[model samples]
Target: METPRERWVGADAGPIVRPYAVTRGRTRPRGMDVDLVTLLVATGRTPGERVWLSREQRRLLELCRHPSTPADLASDTDLPLRVVQILLADLHQYGLVEEVPQAEPAGRSTGRPDPKILMRVLDELRRL
Candidate 1:
């Protein structure tokens, strides 16, 4: 006796999994700190070698093999943001993955370039 709301009348009708369950009731990421933009990549081998991880963690490892951010992983996997961060930190602890900080683009000048440097560049261009 389930209503339409309870059963969304689709082939993929299943109970929604809570984030707490995914994280085993953990509230915060351990040791490592992560943000939405923090990039992660696998360590060239399977993570959680001696431990059993949730299905979500395994999927995250696969997704991060080529470098992915926590935001992207959360959006793509439909997992909570905090949950993803905790999972990533856990993997990092096990040496299954590493955090790769994104660097600011080099092309962007913090402020106006030094007038002397610009003048030199202009002079060099004039010579050519």
Candidate 2:
């Protein structure tokens, strides 16, 4: 049977678009590796329009601004660790963040995922 990963077709290659925060940076992408924190703050600018964020997503973004373990972030944010993992994966895939590997999960653990998986998923999404 085909898996979710195998089911993708196309229509997902386009860049991801998300609203930014209050602060932003000046340099353009052609000049430098974008600072995600600065870029996040720079993306949203609808003069009179309002921006909204859930308490959890906001907290998740804050935790992500620093290099931290998913377990640590989940504990700090009071969210289930798995949910934190999922959110980070989403953020990374959208090019809003990057991740570095840490210790491996214990044998009894469900196991951590590889960030490269998102690249494959992104390609599949593009194909779909």
Candidate 3:
């Protein structure tokens, strides 16, 4: 008999679930768009009070109990950015979390770091 293809196993030897399964075949989120640094805050809903939330959504609530960025959430959750974004969107629809984009400083709003700030930091590092 031929052996089946190897399956992914976790540290506990549990079968690994695919990412797409978690999103229910969604490749994109349905609500507000999010960037890497979009801040998220939990709505502080207690367990058993949440209605029809997925495990990913619950985990997102726990992680965002303290203000955190989507990038941070992805890193901490070991999930892809898209997956986290989708979860955040779901939480948003349920009013379980809020998305706040990081405001860029007035002068640096054009997407480039100010050269003066970089020079100052370089000078300080050289002095140290």
Candidate 4:
């Protein structure tokens, strides 16, 4: 059994998906899976509907429309790269944002990370 409060915002605060929409996989062949911008925009129901986005989170949501890098977001928002990384992690967990995996340069191949690494990292970080 679950309490109403447990099922509320404290439980989660990610984008709300439409019933008929088939959710897309957030993985990529390269670096990391970035957040899904189109879905986030579509989830914002009304102009006045509050989504409880932090300033940086809002800027991140706006900037991720084109697969932005955390460095770029840090520069644009005047936030530290580490801080942006933290927020992005949170957004990704709530299914709001995803990591955009980038390929290494030609002749410079690094092995792709196991998806479990990302999942474990996210789970551990969420407790903070």
Q: Candidate 2: where is the Cα deviation over 4 Å?
A: 1-53, 101-128
Model 2 has how many clashing residue pairs? 6
Compose the digit string of candidate 3's lDDT tens values, residues 33-96: 7677778898775545656778877788999989998899999988889999988888887777
Candidate 4 local distance difference test against the native:
0.53
- Tens digits of per-residue lDDT, candidate 2, 1-128, equal 97665455335633322223211221123222322222221122222224343455567666666666667776786555545555555445444455553456566354535568868989999998
lDDT of 4 by residue, 75-117 (tens): 8876645555556665665556654446665665764556787
lDDT of each: 0.84, 0.48, 0.81, 0.53
Q: Tell me which of candidates 1 and 2 scores higher on TM-score.
A: 1
List candidate 3 segments past 4 Å from native. 1-14, 45-50, 101-128
Off by over 4 Å in 1: 1-13, 104-128
Model 1 accuracy (lDDT, Cα): 0.84
Measured by TM-score, how close is model 4 to the native structure? Answer: 0.43
How would you encode candidate 1's per-residue C-alpha lDDT over 1-128 as one tens digit per residue?
A: 98866764445846677778889899899989988778899997654447787799889988988899999999988888999999999988888889875555578656345688889989999999
Ranking, TM-score, top scorer first: 1, 3, 4, 2
Query: What's the candidate order when arranged by decreasing lDDT?
Result: 1, 3, 4, 2
Query: lDDT: which candidate is best?
Result: 1
Clashes of each: 0, 6, 0, 12
Backbone clashes, candidate 3? 0
